[model samples]
Target: MAATIEMPATRRPIVVAPMAGGPSTPDLVVAAGEAGALGMLAAGYKRPADLIAEIADVRERFTGPFGVNLFVPADASCAPERVDSDSAATGVADAEGRDRADRVAVEAFRDLLVQAAPDVHVPTPDWHDRDHYEDKLDIVEAARVAVVSFTFGCPQPHVVERLHEAGICVLVTVTTEEEAHTAVAAGADALVVQGYEAGGHRGTHRVTDAPNQLDHLALLPMMTDVGVPLIAAGGITTAGDTRRALGAGAVAVQAGTTFLLADEAGTTAATRMGLTDPRLGSCVTRAFSGRPARGLRNGFVDRFDALAPAVYPAVDQLTKPLRARAAQRGDIDGVSIWAGAGWRAAREAPAADIVDSLTP
Candidate 1:
C-alpha cells in the first residue's frame, strides 16, 4: 500500500487559503507559519520571475515550511472556443436578435464604464489567458518549496512526478469526489476538498461545469475514503467548525475568508469595506471572472452574471480595467468582494491572532 501523506507538523491543523489577486501576501504567509499554521502564497496572476521573488521574500521572513498555490491552465479539451473576431467586433446578433453573452456583456459593461467614468481608459481583453501555468511550474520546481497546490485542475502526471522528485508535496484542490479520484490517480500527495462555499473560485476541474453545492464539512466524509490526507476548505469559521471538520476525517481545515481581514493580508481598502459592511451579502457569480466564485453580491454581478460567458481568464481579463478603476476610486460596488459564507466572522487582527482564535 502507498504511504499516507503526512501534513506538516504545526500547533494547529489550520491552513491559510491562498487568496489570489492581492490578499495572499508574504507577511500573511509568514505570520500564519509563525503561529503554527500552514500558509500558501498565491501564484495565479503572477509572472514567473515575480513568483520566485515572492518565494524568496517569504523565506526571508519565515523559515518554516509554507505552500505555493498555482492555477492550472485549462486543458485543451476544455478550452473555450474564441468567438469570431468579426462577430465580436460587430456585436452580431443571432436569429433571436441577441448577441453572444460574452460580447454583449463586455460591450455593455464597457459602455457603462465609459459613461460612469469617461476619463478612465479600459485596456483590451486578452482572449487567451493561461496565466503562464508551465512557466510557474518551472519556478516552483526550482524554488523547491515544501508544498505546491494546484487549483482549477489537477496537474499533469509528469508535473506531479517532477515535484515529487524535488521533495515537494503536491496538493490538488477538488470540489467533488470524482475530482478527488482523478487527483489521486494523478499522484497528488494531498487533497484540498474545496466545497461550494469556498470564496474566490470553485476549484472544479472543468470551467464549463457548474459547481455542485456541497458544504466542505459534509464533503470531508466523502473524501476520507480517498486514502490520502484531506484538507477541508470553505466556510470554516469558529473552533466548532474546525472540530467538526476534524471529526469528519479532515487532517486540516483551510480558511480564506476568515483571514481576509488579517492585518498581514493584502486585502484592499474597498474589499475590506465590503467584507465588514453589514448590508453586503455573498453569492456565487461568474460575472467578474467567468468562473463560479463566491463573493459579496454587488451591482456588477447583479448586472452581468446572466450575460457573462463561461470563458475564464478571458472574462477575468475583460473585467480587469473596470475593477481596477473601481478599486482606484475606492468604489466597493465595482470591485470584486470575493468572500465565503463565513466572511462575517473574519476579524481585523494579526494573521497569527486569527490563527490562534480559529484553531483554539
Candidate 2:
C-alpha cells in the first residue's frame, strides 16, 4: 500500500468530479485548486498524448494538488460473444444465436440513427476497443499526479501496487457497499461512493447491471465500515448537501453537475441551454452511451433509450458523430445534457466561486 498519503479532500473537502467528453478542462482544474479544492482531469475519451498534454498544461498553470480519472475498460469475458465464421455458416441456435441477436439489436439502432439524423455520419461499433486503457495507465504513472481515480470497475491488485510504488494515491468509484468492499480488497486507497443521482455514468462494476436508485446520503452511511476514506458523490450542489455528506462520515464531497456551468468548463451551448430550460427534465438512460447515465430528457433519449444495448464503448462510438453534430447545431433535443438531480441549482460562475459556495 502507498505510505498513507494525505487525501486532497483532507485539505478542502471539496472535489470537482471528472466530467469526461468536454466539461473538465485544465482551467477548471486550476480554478478548483486555486479555491482550495481538488479538481480532476477526465481521461475517459482522450488519447494518451492528449492526456499527457493536459497534465502538462495543468502542472504549468497550477502547482496545487490535482488528479486524473480513467475508465477501466470492460473485460473481454463480459463482452457479447463474437459471431464466428463457423457459427454463421452453421446457423447454430445457441451462444452464436445470442450473439447474432445482439448484433441485430445494434444494427437496428444504427438504422434508427441514420433515419433520424441523415446529415450525421454514424460509424460501425468497435466492439473490442478498450479506450486505450493500457497506454493511459502508462501516461498517468509517469505523470505522478497527486491522485488517480478509476470508474466502471476496480483496478487489479497489481495495478494498485504499481501506482503505490510510484507514490500516487488511488481511488475507485463504487455505487454500493459490496463494491466498496471489493475496491478495498483490491487495494484502493479510498472509494468515491457514487449514488444513482450522480450525473454521467453510474460507475457500476458490471456494464449490464442496472444501478440501484440509492441517493448519496442514503448510501454513504451504509459504507462507513469499509475502512477506507470515503468521498461522497451524486447531486451534491449546495453547502447543505456538502455538510450532510461530511456528517454522514464522508471525508469529502465530489460534485460534477454543479460545475457544468462554470466559466472554465467545456460544456457546449446546447448542454447549457438544456440545464436551464424548465421544459427539459433529467432522467437516467442508456440512449446516448449504452451505459446508464443521468442527463436531461430529450428527443434522442425518448427515441432510443429502450433500444440501446448494454455494450458501452461500442454504443458510445456509434453515437459520437451524431452527438457532435447535435452540439454543433445547438440542438438541445439531440445532445446529452448530463446533469444531477439538483441541476436546477446550477448557475454560471467562476469555478473558484462555485467551489467556495459549495464549501461548508
Candidate 3:
C-alpha cells in the first residue's frame, strides 16, 4: 500500500473518525499517527477516569499528535423542558388496542435499551452537569492533546476558547449546515461535516431537531456555508469514495465504519462475528442511545423503535445493564452493532494496513 499522504503537519487533513464502544482504542490512535493520519480517541462513551487512563496509554505509545473526541452533553436532554401535553408526543392513544400496543412496546423498549447497551456506548460522561465535563477537558489539556473534537452537540463557546487557549485545536462534528454555522460561531477550528451515511450517531445540534435528509453527495455541496475547513465523514468505504468527497470540496475525509473491523481496533467479537452473517444489515435506532444512530439491525431493534424516546442519557443509563448482559452471552439480539452503509467494504487486516491503503 502506498502510505503517502499529501498534507503537511499543520494541515494533516485525514482524520480517523472516533467510533465509541470499542474501535477507538489507544493502539489505534498510535497507528493513525504512524499511518500519517490524525486519530481521535472517542470520548463519547468513557468516564473521565477511564478516558484519562486511555489518554495516558496512548501517550506512552505515541508521543506525536492525536485528538480526543467528546460528546458535548446537551444542556436540555439531561433535564428536558416539561412537556405541556403528552397527547402531542410519541405515546398518545385513543383506542384500547393502541394503548395495549404502546404498553407492550414500552416493555419491549426497556428490554431493547438493556440489550443495546451491552458494554455499549454512552452519549457523554453520563449526563450534563454531572458528566464531569470540565474535569475531562482539564485532563485532556494536561496531556497536551493536539486536537479536541466533539460530537452530539457543540460545546459552550467558553469551553472551546479554553481548549484553544490551551493550544488544542477544536473540531465539532455537525450533520447540517445550520449546525456547522453554529459550531463556527461558537469557535470551532474545523468542521467535521457528517452526512446521513455516517455510521454512528449523526451530530445534529438539536436533539429534538430532525437529521437532514441528504445523502453525502447532496450534503457535500451545502457544507460550503460553514466557512471552515470541511472534513466529510460517513459512508466512505473505498478509495473512490475518498476521492469523491475531496473532489466535492472537502479538504479531507474522515472515516469510522472502515475501522470497525480493523485488527488494532477495539471492536467486540460479537460485532466482528455478526458482520460476516450477511443477514444483519444496518439501520438507525434510538434503542441504544436516546439519539438515532445507524447500526446492524437485529431482533432488538426489530422489536423497539416506536417506543424509544428522543430522550438520550436517561435511556442510555436505563438500558446499560441489558446491553451488557447480551454482549456477555454473544447475543446479537441485544448488543449495539454500529456500522455504515459500507459494511460490505470492511476488511479484516491490521488497522495500519487499512490506514495506509486509504491515504493517497
Best by lDDT: 2
lDDT of 3: 0.74
lDDT of 1 by residue, 88-159 (tens): 544344312332565665666556546755776755666566788888888988988889999998877778
Q: Model 3: per-residue lDDT, tens digit, 240-277?
A: 78788888888888998888888889999888877877
Per-prediction backbone clash count = 0, 0, 7
List of clashing residue pairs for candidate 1: none
Model 2 agreement with the true structure over 186-267: per-residue lDDT tens digits: 8889899998889998998877778999988888889999889899999899888899999999989999999999999998
- At residue 206, what lDDT does model 1 achieve? 79
lDDT of each: 0.84, 0.87, 0.74
| Reference-based TM-score of each model | 0.88, 0.92, 0.83
- Order of candidate numbers by lDDT, starting with the best: 2, 1, 3
In model 1, where do residues sit more than 4 Å from their true spots? 1-5, 76-120
Quick one: ranking by TM-score, best first? Answer: 2, 1, 3
Taking every candidate in turn, the Cα RMSD to the unseen true structure, in Å, is: 5.5, 4.2, 7.3
Clash count (model 2, backbone only): 0
